[model samples]
Target: MRYIISYVSTVNPDLSNTDIAKLMDHVNVHNNTIGLTGILIYSEGNFFQVLEGEEEIVKRMFERIKKDSRHYNIIKMLDKEMNDHSFSEYHSSFTVISDHYSQTELQEFLNKEKDYNPEHYKSILYLTQKFMKLL
Candidate 1:
């Protein structure tokens, strides 16, 4: 079965912008190599991410994520088996919502995703808005 997990986490205060960029680079490369697809948004010291892939692989990745020291206060908003992969449009993606304009653009892009589950889409939008408001 395929699985999806979405979560928001507080970034480690000690990390610099360069560190975050390196982290995003690693994520994109590793996820592509492992055949996972998802989107990640970071803003205002928080990260909102959705990862989808094989059930066991996704679960294992989440476990590893829980152990990563770059972030804390992790709150998983969604996790379940999924019959469809809504984020396959990209192998893996990352973005930083720095301002209202970026947030609006991202929201518009997400809204245009026809394959995304409405419930999941709404949940993501809520989390994104929450993070953006903190910026």
Candidate 2:
């Protein structure tokens, strides 16, 4: 089965921007071999990411991510099986939300998830669509 998982995590203060870039590069390479696709957003020392792939593999990946020392306070925001891949365009696209979108827009965008849309994804989809075009 195909699955997608989204989570928000606190970035470890000790790591620099270069370290995060290197980590994402490593993740992208590993994700490619495993058939995963998604986007990662980092801003204000927090990471919001969506990963999609085979169920077991994605679960395992999330587990490994949970244990990675580079980030903490992992909070899963979405988990579901999907008929089609929503993020097939990239193996692991990275976006710094602050770079392309204003903090006000991002905050306003994030504050309005009272319910999920018909497709089961919520506000994250909107954020993904806007950022995906930038890459």
Candidate 3:
């Protein structure tokens, strides 16, 4: 079985682009090394991320995330075990929604995956929408 976790949080406003880039690099390397896959989206001052991998590792990573000083107001949107990882093809993805076009692209990408798992997709889409609304 695979474990998946999705959450939204506010990033530290003081973080510069360079800081965020470095953070993303660390996340990618760490997650890939642990055999995890998922997507992370940031916009305005908010962050939305989904992580899928081994149950223990994902849960451990989430705990570390909760303690990370760079963000706050962590609100978990989803946490459960599933038969497969919906985003196994991607090692780890990070996107910044800077404008309506980027947001639209993200929506389209999620829309295209609607058939993968309706329940999961619905929840993921809803979380993204909710995260976007924070912008």
True-structure lDDT of candidate 3: 0.72
- lDDT of prediction 2: 0.66
Model 3 steric clash pairs: none
Superposition-based RMSD of candidate 1 using all C-alpha atoms, in angstroms: 4.7
The global C-alpha lDDT for each of the candidates, from Candidate 1 onward, is 0.72, 0.66, 0.72
Q: Which candidate should be chosen as best, given TM-score against the real structure?
A: 1
Separate clash counts for every candidate = 0, 0, 0
- Lowest summed lDDT over 10 consecutive residues: which window, candidate 3? 88-97
Evaluation by lDDT, superior candidate among 1 and 2: 1
lDDT for predicted candidate 1 compared with the true structure: 0.72
Candidate 2 per-residue lDDT, tens place, 12-86, comes to: 999898887887788767787778876676656777787878999889999999999989999887787766565
TM-score of each: 0.75, 0.71, 0.74
Using lDDT as the measure, name the better of candidate 2 and candidate 3.
3
| Alpha-carbon deviation at 7 in model 2, angstroms | 0.4
